[model samples]
Target: MLVAMALFALALERLIYWRVTHRRARRALIDAWIQRRDHVSWSALTLREVWTRELLARLRQPLPWLKLLVAVCPLLGLLGTVTGMIQVFDSLSLSDSGQARAMADGVARATLPTLVGMAVAVVGLLFVSRLEQIIRREDQRLHDRMARAVEDAHA
Candidate 1:
């Protein structure tokens, strides 16, 4: 659970950072790319492609790991659940099986891990979805900006 939360925190921090810094980062990236250009052509499609490639390259660094972490969090919780159930079964096998109190306690213990795992999965899914939205919005903005740049250069 702690590991899952930590991963969520890291993902949220990066997503927020990107949201806050995107404009400056985009400008800097465009400037850098412009400087390295061997030829000049006001081709919006070409520029858009380059921007997409760059965006993918940048996002590739952290997005997959964030997704993996989010995905693993639920599995970890499931593992906990499985382990808890095993213990409950073991306890049941060793003792008087008719005690409602013992059975209830075991059931509670078994459910706690599953509940926690579900909660982590929900939280992780929220963060991952939000980050993907942010990335998609940024990509669209970059595409529009590149189109405008191409028009301005041609003019």
Candidate 2:
């Protein structure tokens, strides 16, 4: 749910940027963005600058959450395994049923949470890796454009 909302926000940001960038009033707006360079503003940058900023921003967002999720999975698995073993012990206290049968049921019951945790972790991992690469690419693009802008300024 959170991931989807983040993605939606990213999309909206892109849409807003694209809309503003294509407007005939871009020169005036960019001039404004430049003159207001108190602390947070970039002096004057290309459309590429804005695009790269958005991409890099989106890329870094999910990594911490993904790392935390991955770390939690193994803990949940261990917890499930421990509880399953406890159930086996409880079953062992009975004379009619064997410990093996109880152990099997316990293992099965515990596996569900482990699977869910691992699945969440895996999904996070996959997306985070992809985002990392994209962010790097965006950063590189920004650098290239900045370099060109610097060259133009020197000229």
lDDT of 1 by residue, 1-155 (tens): 67676777787677766766655778876665545433245674476578777764675467777777767777787788788878888888888666888877887887787677678777877877877787787777776775566556557
What TM-score does prediction 1 earn? Answer: 0.74
The CA lDDT of each predicted structure is 0.71, 0.56
Please provide, for model 2 over 1-155, each residue's C-alpha lDDT reduced to its tens digit, 9 standing for 90 to 100. Answer: 34334443544454454345423233443344444434223544455366445545654654665566556665776677678667766666665766676567777886776676566567656655665675576577556655554455457
What clash count does candidate 2 reach? 0
Stretches of candidate 1 exceeding 4 Å from the true structure: 31-48, 149-155
Give the TM-score comparing model 2 with the true structure, all chains together. Answer: 0.52
Candidate 2 has its poorest 10 consecutive residues by lDDT at 22-31
* Candidate 2, superposed: residue stretches over 4 Å from native: 1-62, 94-96, 145-155
Give each model a TM-score: 0.74, 0.52
lDDT value, residue 82 of candidate 2: 73
Best by lDDT: 1
- In angstroms, the error of model 2 at 9 is 12
